[model samples]
Target: MRVETVQLKGYTTLGVGGPAELWTVETPEDLKEAAQAPYRVLGNGSNLLVSDQGVPERVIKLGGVFTAWDLNLTPRNGAYITGWIGAGAMLPLLVQEAARKGLSGLEGLLGIPATVGGAVRMNAGTRYGEIADALEVVEVFHDGQLRHYRPEELGFAYRTSHLPPGGIVTRVRFRLTPSTPKAVREKMALVDQARKGQPKKKSAGCAFKNPPGDSAGRLIDVHGLKGLREGQAMVSLEHGNFIVNLGGATARDVWRLVQRIRSVIPLELEWEVWGVIE
Candidate 1:
């Protein structure tokens, strides 16, 4: 295990945050040991925004054994396949491997920078599909015990899951259909192309969940909030729902911009913002 006191900005995709006690665990044993105490589990940090004052609890990052995944093709009726993936595995890598094996399921998550655990916990998805759509079983460690859970048990919904508090997902099982590699690649390319309008800078993906059938980006854009700036953080001109960090932006800057949007937007819209602002 590697231990250090480091700035959270280095760990998050947003590139802004304060310092915290960080622990990198290489084995399941180490993870369990660390979990015995109150700690925050961080994955790829794609959808998180830590506070400027920094996190007070210990931060645990999975590595080594947690990243190892095995692909088992179990044939049933000779028409479909079942895949089991490690929770710590990267979503993009899993998509690539599935495509290579002529399997079709996770194409919609092509550009999302998240691990399986985080994706499943958030029911991460786009207009194409969600992780829960293909998820069959989730193996997680909770209260010092390892258990398997069905999708229904998770209460999956828009950008949220009812995973037991303090639970750590260790593996995921997906049900995929047989497909031609060409077709799989085409789907992935289509999703990639669709995301061209999204900002490519340092951002915590979408800043808020779309309200019902309405799009959050469209609402923010219509309100003329795009390109709005607070210190070094600015609402992305390309996508209104995203707030990008410009060089030395601090977490406070992003929080203030979010507050501005929330206060100015109509109250009936009922949109929920993502990230931890502290």
Candidate 2:
């Protein structure tokens, strides 16, 4: 494992944040050693907003051995195929890999920029399906001890899974159904098509979770909050729920815009805030 002091803006999708001590742990033993010190596990750095002042704790990122995943195209007895994936494996690569392997279940996760562990931790999904739909077991290293947990035990809900505090997911096992190459590609295309409306700008994905029986985007749009801007951060006109970084936006700017939006309509924040927002 190697440690470096780097600007957090380069690590997150939002492109806003200050400096932090980042540790790249490549192996399980590396993770155990890193965990001995106070740390925070960072996935693909999506769906989060880190403070401009940065955090007092260290940020640990999985890599090397933790980025490996095993996927087999052929099933043993013409049944479901099981595979173990590292928490650090990027989802875009896995989605393409699965498609190439004639797998169709992950189509719903198209366009989500996240790691396997990050996707599972947040139950990342769209209308087609969720990551939890095919998940079986999650292996995590917590408090210097390794443990296996079923999905039910994690309390999976919409866009969120309740993992114990300081629990670092090391790997995950998934069960997927095989399909024809053409069919799998088609499903992925459809899922991608559905996501075409999302903003292409720098953002931490959706800014607010959809309230039950209602969408935060719809609410924001209906309230005429589209195009709302604070500093360099703005509510995307394409999708009201997205707060886009219009270049050089600060974390405080995004949070101020978020507060502006929240003032008009009550919506729960979907993005996990790091450090203080004020």
Over 164-217, each residue of candidate 2 has an lDDT whose tens digit, in order, gives 898988888777887877899998888888787899999999999999899999
Q: Once model 2 is optimally superposed onto the true structure by TM-score, how far is the C-alpha of residue 267 displaced, in angstroms? A: 0.3
lDDT tens digits, residues 93-157, model 1? Answer: 98898899878988998888899998998888988999999887898888988889989999999
Model 1 superposed RMSD (Cα): 2.5
Which candidate leads in TM-score?
2
What TM-score does each of the candidates earn? 0.93, 0.96
Clashes of 1: 0
* lDDT for residue 146 in candidate 1, whole number 0-100: 80
Measured with C-alpha atoms, the lDDT of residue 135 in candidate 1 is 84
Runs of candidate 2 exceeding 4 Å displacement: 73-79
Worst 10-residue lDDT window, candidate 1: 266-275
RMSD of each: 2.5, 1.5
